[model samples]
Target: MSYDHISESLTLLQKDWSVDPILVDFMLGKRTDVTDHAVKVGQVIFHIPYITGEKKFILWKCYWPDCHNCCERQGRLPLTSDDLITIGKGLKYQKTSDFVKNETLVATWMESGPSGNNVLMTSVNLKRKIDETESDDGTHIRCRFLDEKGACSMHPNRPGVCYLYPFSSWLENETGRARVHSTYQFTGDCPGFFLEGSLDSMKETLKEYSNTIYDYTMKYTRTTREGFSLTSFV
Candidate 1:
């Protein structure tokens, strides 16, 4: 599924809160009032929001095995070049082409370009177990790597999108750094969001997630510009 609407909303929200003291205080854990703020890295707004209510900011902690909501109903898990290489290696595929051909589907969709134009981008998505008896509404599908115990069989070498689960990132402009965003706004069903967690811990997680996303994005941009498909890259 395309995330153009989410990006557009984040862009508008950033504009609205260009100089927000409420968000500042919220980040510092000093605000008791309810409000929403986008997570950011060095002034680059992330799509994830820090939503507060009932005089406290909501925090999240993944409840993986206990709650497999994300894995069960995941819509699209786009794979990056790095993810392809790592997963191919883990699966003992000697050739990336062989792995891609056997394990993934090439998905192409239109998204809003950096300059507000439309661009068609192609990427590889991990294939999911298809249930012929079920409706094709995406709700009945699950990742192929998801095991019976609700654990990822390819945990150590899962795709980049899986690693960044419950969160996503994008560069607002081609020249700017990528910003992090929570997948909460889109999914709205993650049980993790209802639980309480440490703000510092969340920040630390965002730091790692943001860095990984930035690296993957840079590699993706370079590979696409070089006229190589994601699956063809090492």
Candidate 2:
């Protein structure tokens, strides 16, 4: 799919999402707690401190069914081996014995990023599995962990990419410094960019983190052949 299409889809989602009031208040200093290191909305956070003096936030709340559906419609979701195992063991998928142990399933699920880094299929598959599981849209896309409600069955054990959804990490070439980036704004449609209120400073911090993550991912991809894994990003 074109970059434009991806950007548009994310933009639409962003517009529909509402910033958590708890997050807004926390960032605005309306809510204070010495022990408060993160915001929790369905176990989410508006701020996550990775490095000393570096602060990040969950700028956009993950809108469940919509986000899930969008990814399916676009055929861009991915899954990792661990995700497969978790779903299989959880009794979420039928015929788990046949599919989970199949090495060919492993090979077919592999994906390569723009940097030629390889990763396992946790979401979309180009080669459709000839079974009731695969979608007929030609993308062969199916998230095995996705529940009937459109929520991830393995939400807690989801991959790093899922944790950093609508966001990416990058690394600087010269300083070797890392940063975070918001895919929403980079793609140019996050309403969070236009949000105005007493939370300006908080939003600015999020922006800084966004940029940092972008560089961090870039540097990470350069040195890591397997690409960023779920545990590492989390």
Candidate 3:
């Protein structure tokens, strides 16, 4: 009953956090070694709470059309100069692609799914791996994808932990134990996932992925905090 594979599947969000927070929850530690306890968690914004005159055109950039996700002055993702420094420390890039220009990128950005192929600009909306079947069939993670459709055709080549759908992540919890569940949510408003579960349930799933986000954030923070170069840091 473990979905750790998804955790590894996603490269983890390596970028810095915006004030809004991608926001997801998860069990920090393991309740049982072999249990689906080590699951992958994620959460995404599902449109902002408001959209007035100025706010509507705020360029609320977290993906999704009617999504205000979290309107930042510059962008939903708030990566500081240090974060850029850390990014350099962690990965190697020749010429900056959309990530550099956009400035708002996820630790595990993806670009594949059921709808042919279009770069998935955002992170995983919700995920909790548990196979289909009466037995709860392990745990099938439903990584955020097309609205009512399948996922990217090239989903296999997707980067970051996003590819790790239906998976769970392990984090340090208050009781000092990592747990597992079978639900997840998207950050911004999405049409695909808006049934069965309520907002609270979606929030819980998001929290799990958020923790995984922090876990991956460490890699860059460690390097950037040290004033490392892009070559060495990345």
Candidate 4:
């Protein structure tokens, strides 16, 4: 019933949104080198017709692929600037900038919104470090705190995003509130989470996690939209 350990195992996209047959094979245990390993989860991107509006969310095996392997193959885990700061402070790193370059940290900039005047929205991104010279290579950024074994060096102190992986939440256009769900188009999406009962057991917790991000995103979006204005530039 307690899949807390299991939930912490999932991670983000290794490559871009498009699926990779090779990685798929590796995950599916079809590759020669990775014959023993099998993909326990598949990712599903979908939009829900919520009362607020059509909201999008990605549903995947929150666990499996395991952080150990995920670290070796995937980019750094996504986190907000505040999360990174916490991680840096926990690691006792003097300058967070030293750990990661500005570019490595991906952000969503909403140049303009419905107001039509000018609304900017920034989204956080996860990245890793290959070394001092090679900080981030587009989508290949590595987490500086990732150990050789693919474990987060700064565990427990990680960001909310890290805590809520293989799952996500979004703002409903109708209600303008965050909504979370564990139900997804499970057809062939997540191989790791094959048992519905397992998922059912953790649905409540997953929902909670989903709303957490949703609320965070909503507040962030609201603050950014209200605080910044085009005139501020002039």
List the global CA lDDT of all models. Answer: 0.57, 0.40, 0.29, 0.40
C-alpha RMSD values across all candidates: 9.7, 11.8, 19.9, 12.3
Q: Give the TM-score of candidate 1.
A: 0.63
**Model 4 worst lDDT run, 10 consecutive residues:** 35-44
TM-score of each: 0.63, 0.40, 0.22, 0.46
User: Counting only residues 3 or more apart in sequence or on different chains, how many pairs clash (N, Cα, C under 3 Å) in candidate 1?
Assistant: 2
Judging by lDDT against the true structure, name the best candidate.
1
Q: Against the true structure, whose TM-score is highest?
A: 1
Off by over 4 Å in 4: 1-69, 75-78, 93-126, 130-142, 176-191, 195-199, 204-208, 211-234
Which of candidates 1 and 3 reaches a greater lDDT? 1
Error of 2 at 232 (Å): 21
Clashes in each model (backbone N, CA, C under 3 Å)? 2, 26, 66, 21
For model 2, residues 38-116, the per-residue Cα lDDT tens digits are 3322211233322222243333433454556433432333334444455455545566454454411322244334245
Off by over 4 Å in 1: 1-58, 110-119, 130-140, 174-185, 195-201, 226-234
- The better candidate by lDDT, 1 or 2, is 1
- Model 2's alpha-carbon lDDT is 0.40
Tell me which of candidates 1 and 3 scores higher on TM-score. Answer: 1
Give a tens-digit lDDT track for model 4, residues 1-234.
012322222223332233334434333434454111111221211232111111212224444334343344333344555665776677566887754454245443333322345543344454455332323322333556677666677677765555544444333343873333222321123333322212345445544555555554554445446532111210
Model 2 spans > 4 angstroms off: 1-142, 176-194, 197-223, 226-234
lDDT (tens digit, per residue) of candidate 3 on 42-103:
42222212112112111112233443111111012223344444443344544334234333
Q: How does model 4 score by TM-score?
A: 0.46
